[model samples]
Target: MRDLEGRYVNCCSLRYGLSFFIHFCNIAIAAQRVCLSLTMVVMVNTTYSHELHNSSTNELLTNVKNPVYDWSPETQGLILSSIFYGAAIIQLPSGYLSGIYSIKKIVGCGLFLSSLCSLLIPLAAAFGKTSVIVCRVVQGIAQGMASTGQHEIWTKWAPPRERGRLTSICLSGFLLGSFIVLLVTGFICESLGWPIVFYIFSAYGGVLCLLWFVLVYDDPKDHPCISISEKQYITSSLVQQFSSSQQSLPIKSMLKSLPIWAISFATFGYFWSNTILFLYIPMYINSILHVNIKENGLLSALPFLFAWICGILSGQMADFFSSRSILSTTNIRKLFTTLGLLLPVLFSMCLLYLSSSYFSTVIFLILASATGAFSLPGMMINALDIAPRYYGFLKGVTILVGMIGGLISSTLTGIIINQDPESPWFEVFFLMTAVCLACLIFYLIFGEGEIQEWAKERKHTRL
Candidate 1:
């Protein structure tokens, strides 16, 4: 079939198929991680804690079917942040391994391990808080490897021209996961009990893991089912950017690069803001806004649904600009990254002032999330832009920085919320906004879109 652009299309193209499969993999990765965000609401008994002051939100304590623990705010913070700690430990190593080994195997194994961890969370919870924390940490490590492997997969499977769209499609799965979990988990907790939510998602993940092992290949050339035309298109587009010859890593060069630092800091900013929304928004809505469990799930989910849409559209727009030469790669990256970071801050500030109005608060949140997704097509994939050869390793470094920031942000948020209890949201929002702005400025000043000399393949000279 010919598409509207007059290009021949293969409905069964393995490259596109791979993008979608990874998309589902990402969905599983996110669901496993964020299940705690909503479930924790029901899992913890706020009334049981002496540290907690009386609040109207304590009304939720009357109706929970599942057993609730007397977890202090600090303890809750540790549970939420433990995943990031495990993820950070694996990020660099996983990135390096993904680049050297089979992306298919690395990603598959990671997802399978993560799925296994997810399955054990309910069992862990029965043992004690410590067991659950340990389970989450292991899940985080596995998901980190899977996330890093995705960047490596694109290095081998994605055409240079199609990179933005393909990567965005895969990354959008993160938002999709958030949307589903936020929409469904609370209702499941209320109706069937909290453990069922974990059981259902983990079971789905296990099935997808089996499919991943059967269908995915490390590269376009390796897939037996990929069409010849599609294989040639992908391989030819990537040939100049990749090399089979192994060389020692240019660690020193990367350490000194301004662009690398820029990506790392920008990632930190993104993760800080993201951690607040993904992990804490449910708490904010329930505790502060007094939204019920079902309504809270639905409202929190709305922003992510819009964000997923915006992510996909921005990816398409980015590739269009690149293919048509309407803008330089640097400009495209800057423009989208700016939109992704700046407008969210503006919208979030608006959310604070308009918090008294429930409708306006939700609208602003939706706008913030929708606009923030532009970053997916922006700095999120800039490593691929400047260094396809080292994209996997570079992504790992940036993500490690991001995970550390997320870990700190989650812990700090819990500490801050615990200290004030009555009016902590404003202070938390302000700190998050300030950190995001500082990092965005660093990226705008130093980020680059051109490939570095150190990233290019070098010819070996025989002595």
Candidate 2:
């Protein structure tokens, strides 16, 4: 009887194992089937009528289709600076719109339109001066669309706890784009012409836009593709999570805040000082320091790369202090902001005074780059901290002001450099330092955020 019972038990256990295996196989097959079907659907949807990708580096560089094109230095400066102008100026309105509508929709539309503008740059260059200017203006507006929409996404997607890393990642795109461009553009430029750079950017814009429509869902709760684990993670982290109860924030009240002005001023200083690097750094190096073209481009890239790295590092620092619970959020923000702003201002001044040799100029830029890290945790992080709800709008507000500053800085620097290149660089450097210092002191006292006070404040514009 015992032997018979043992045999029966073993048989039952074996049957149970076989059934479980079958069930597991069925689940695995179902999951694969679901994945396949979803992928097919997404792929089809991704083929939007407005898909923007076209052209290549070699094609753009070598294409002389624009026989009317003139590649003068001034024209180049206008082309580049106009993009910043448009990006900064358009940010406010675009961001406000993003807050009112779906950020995903705003970003997707902006990127698609911007990619189209990018493709037409060569066409503009081919037409005449007027066409190039028009294309550049369009490009800048497109950037405003891209930047502001990104801020909207950041506010919604990034939780307070993880905002630091997310901000770093997003902001790093500016430099990462530059770094990738630098590494890749050299080969492209060597093989083709400068036109290829814009072509490459256009391609990037298209791919990113397509991905946005496919993977990105506007509201966290409304997302179809998100798994349960991801849904839990996002909702748990947001301090002011988006909901049906909340409506769009008031634009007028936000614009009137002293903190906004302070942030704007600091951003202005950043753009003002940095534009020199973008516009005339190579010329300065070649004229003042006598560096070769190959060396200058690499050296020029260093500051931006360092600034990007510092942003990542500073973010980690903020998170570290936050976890300890020793420092108030205000203090952590203030500390990093002050450091980011102050160091750049101070180092910028050093350029004015220091003329030891060619090496000294490079050293100044490297130090300034290191200091540029300060902006990351301060303005970039603090903007999100103050109003994670209205990040797109605020980013647009401050960025627009900064672009105005850039116009002033670049214009003045250009005029001064033409007359007396050496002394003017120094003078501008010191002036920027003073301006930065002024912004810093102001922020120390007036620029801060308190959540209790958040609802009490309203922006000036109701609409």
Candidate 3:
């Protein structure tokens, strides 16, 4: 009887397994993407320190250390931003291909390729900045494809009511990865050397790529290990909502879609703020709060840890509200997006006022990140809402827009800080706030809950 009950449970839970696998996969993706943010702090030359002094003093601090390279802030920004350039090129094509081909294969292959590029990065650094950037770009391309494929997977596997929960759980892996990376990177740089960071994270992605190929399937009907009952449950749930898996691209209609535009704008703002958090928070802790490298890593990671925890919880809350019909889908998405984006802006603004208080600054940053994770259940999964059939494609478009935002954010941040590393933070916060508020307002006004006519399934006609 125990064995029979176990079999019955397995017959209903394959979707959950899929969600967990993707969750781990996202962790791998994020680890590789964010490892460099902290690692670079230790890699650069320190002949001239960029650390700032309090308002009472004006002396520039100088330190001598065994630094690996002497790349300037502008060059570092270019290297950080280069990945987005490669990712932007692939997101649209990979997103469309994932919808048309096997999502399992596309995602697995992308991870494999990205992992390989990660292994090459340390060696590339020996040649110079350009070589490192090239390797990073390749990694970005792989990550872009794999990340987009995950969205397509949800279109096939997730029930409408479960989307917020499943998608949020999966995306929370991103923050988890960032947390783990930031938490360990400084220690690793100080103890094991920075190259080991690349090797460790790359090996993780390679192993996950193998497991993904072996265990994951593009659709419920195609999964060999899924029980008949499980397969039937997924298919039946999605049948009325989506047409056949393959459909021609509705280019013209999508071009005219206000909801799509709303998603794109919101995604742009979301990623801009996220990029700042992921790339610059460590620098802020080090430069403004006067934290050492090791403590900087731990402190930088705190926000992401809080964000990850809150993201998973918010997913459940969003789903509860959705399932109980307490709020319409549009309202739910808007509500979460507003909380995530707007709250962070307020917290970030507080940083400008309390820049001198390390404890206060850390608390606000943590609060900001915790609230920002709400976006995971907000605009992030909205593509699945308006276009279940073309979710992969729409996700690609919006993510591409978001990547552009990130690219600009990283590059522009360097330019802003390089102008005067001491006093330019206000400008940075102001720009991020403006972009987020503008985008959030647009999303609230125009976003939709139901499927678009162009995205609806078409009935077959007799020849």
Q: Which runs of model 1 end up more than 4 angstroms from their true locations?
A: 1-12, 46-72, 286-288, 354-356, 419-426
For residues 200-261, write the lDDT of model 2, one tens digit per residue: 66676677667667766666667775555545655666644443345557667666677777
The candidate 2 region of ten consecutive residues with least summed lDDT is 32-41
Return the number of clashes found in candidate 1: 0
Number of the top TM-score candidate: 1
Candidate 2 colliding pairs = 61-193, 252-459, 252-460, 252-461, 253-458, 253-459, 253-460, 254-459, 340-374
Candidate 1 vs candidate 3: which has greater TM-score? 1
Worst 10 residues of 1 by lDDT: 55-64
Could you tell which candidate, 1 or 2, scores higher by lDDT? 1
Q: Cα lDDT of model 1 overall?
A: 0.83
Off by over 4 Å in 3: 1-12, 46-67, 70-73, 354-356, 420-422, 460-463
**Model 3 lDDT on a 0 to 1 scale:** 0.83
Candidate 2 runs further than 4 Å off: 1-68, 71-76, 225-227, 239-243, 246-252, 352-360, 452-463
102-188: candidate 1 lDDT, tens digit per residue = 888888889999989988987888788899899989988999889887788888887766777888899999899988887788778
RMSD of 3: 6.3
- Residue-level lDDT of model 3, residues 1-463, one tens digit each, is 1132232223138887788778888899999988887777767865644544441232321122223788998788788767778889999898888788888888899999988988888888879999989988888899999998888888878878778988988999988998898777777766667888999999999999988878887778888887787677667778888766477888999999999999999999998998886678877877777877668768878888899998998888998887678999989999998988899899999888864666888898788667789999899998899999898888999999998898788779889998977787889989999999999999999998889998897768999
Please rank every candidate by TM-score, starting with the best. Answer: 1, 3, 2
lDDT of each: 0.83, 0.61, 0.83
